[model samples]
Target: MKRPTLSKKIDQLIYRNHKSATTNVIGCLVLHAIRSEIFERFQRAYVGMANKESSELGNLPTSPMAERARTCETTGERLRNRELAYGFDLDYKNDPPTLVPCTWSKNYAIGLYGRIGLQCYNLQNGTNLKFKRLEKHSTKRTGRYSSVYITLDATDPATGSVCSFQTQFSNAGSHLRLRARITWLTFAARIKQIPNEPIDDDWDEDTPGINEFYKVPLPKWFSDERGSKKYYVPESELHDNDWLQLLMEVAFFSKANRRLDAYLPLELNSVVVETLEDEPRDKLKADNAIFYISYKCCADPCSTPLAGDHRAVVRKTMDGKPGHMCLEVAFTKEQNKNEEE
Candidate 1:
């Protein structure tokens, strides 16, 4: 008779470890967490070695991965991202937290965290940064709390570039949850501050000055002619377009951590308003006019949403960075939220 397979053995362990409560879910989450955690550590060593290697590298090692790891290898840092990703285990287990693509990226935990950290950087330094993306990340876990480090790409928005930044906070509970008690979060910032411009401190980010706000002229990414200057876009730029699509991507992510009652995509209500429909024309008259589309959303995928979710996106083109957006569904009389308390 053949012995039990590794899958079966782990299944047995789960039933015993978790007392058979949501064993399947727990097992899957454990798999993703371990996979991401292990892969992260492995990639770091590989890349460090790869960069130092003289000969050009080819396909990476894939023969026989080991069951027992080395002491020297595991000794340094352990993001324990699996723990960081624990919250997302339920809904968005498909997309775990890790490094991701640049400015304007969203949908996954990596992108979401990058933007959130960037916003913190902006608030502290009076400088407005337009460029962003995750270049590198490392984390240290102790008990239920973990310290995260990011080599962020905070470029200039006008030339379309990168900037590096980080920030820290002290709280007790989990970092993902705002209720953390007393923890130390250290964020490193190496961003070249945007010059000659003041931040949009009012409800409307109206800043007028000499700006490098040129149309994105990248060869394949070049956009065509004009629409109304007041944040207006025609049908071409509205539906099925990259400009509008990126805006909507965050609509779902913005609320990812919030609690909700409506079923996703089905009960998820969305209706596009004509761009600049009610925006003041005076603001668009500036020669330094930059364009972007903004929308609303909540965040969720593999885990339960947090207490906060509803959010309005800010469209900042001149600087290569994103700013704060106050969120609330539009209505005359106050309406009861479809989300649960």
Candidate 2:
């Protein structure tokens, strides 16, 4: 039998929601197109592997081929789940909110595509999660006002953990808030504890508590409730410095209907206000244009910076206009040369 096409499935879903008239048909179509592209790429890889034969002998390697096929099948199932999570259906009311698997190659795509799917769902069906709009600001007088808000709650299904959500409105317009929200079910779930080590200090009796000789601390998991000595384990040896793994859910909200436009007066000439040594001067000069800017916390926000850290530059020319300035931003790590030296 022939397999059903993604477009066909989308059409069926759209038809089912015909009565409600609340569905964003175009949004669904866009999701379908993305899924189709991903599926085709996965299928091509699978087929290529299946057709390959073993090199040394005359026979093909059945085990590796079978494993590849299984991996492809798993990938296909994940894609299907993603479609269902984003697809419009009447039965979604009874289903739980799920995360779509993100491919390593297309990790960045998750933010945009996931937001589109989420916003569409929010518009069609009101979620139980709640949030408060904090403030709205506008840089350009003629442009739309950007609203900022905080997510009250978030829940993660994999670990049954909950966390407070916070995000800024880069897409907020005058009337619409495009921010994402946590589902009510996820918000209600209880948080789970992560395994961690406890710290201990052994000091000399004669020394002051503030300035006493001390010993290294033990891991929390190895320490008893009394906090004196490390709890001994019979079967396995534990270390004091092991890292703990905790799972938390977080959500992003993008507001819509507002476009912030930046226009630089052409007559004004560009000048280098200040230049630092060892900086990418050429790239910096390319991005000195006036434009709407959005900021988000850098990945690994808690990580310490090192020397010779690098960041990629992202630049966009304003509406492709000539003599228009481009805005560029780069993520770089701050280094403490004094400490290293």
TM-score (C-alpha) between model 1 and the true structure: 0.27
Estimate the TM-score of every prediction: 0.27, 0.15
lDDT of each: 0.36, 0.27
**Over the stretch 123-222, how does candidate 1's per-residue lDDT look in tens digits?**
4454456535555444445345453434456655566655445422111232222211112222323342322122232222343422323222211111
Deviation from truth (RMSD, Å), model 1 = 22.2
Residue 197 of model 1, lDDT score: 21
- Give the alpha carbon lDDT tens digit for every residue of 225-307 in model 2: 43222212222211211100000011111111111121111111111111111222332222122111122322343442211
Tell me, by TM-score, which candidate is best.
1
Kindly report which residue stretches of model 1 are placed more than 4 angstroms away from their true locations once superposed: 1-107, 158-161, 166-341
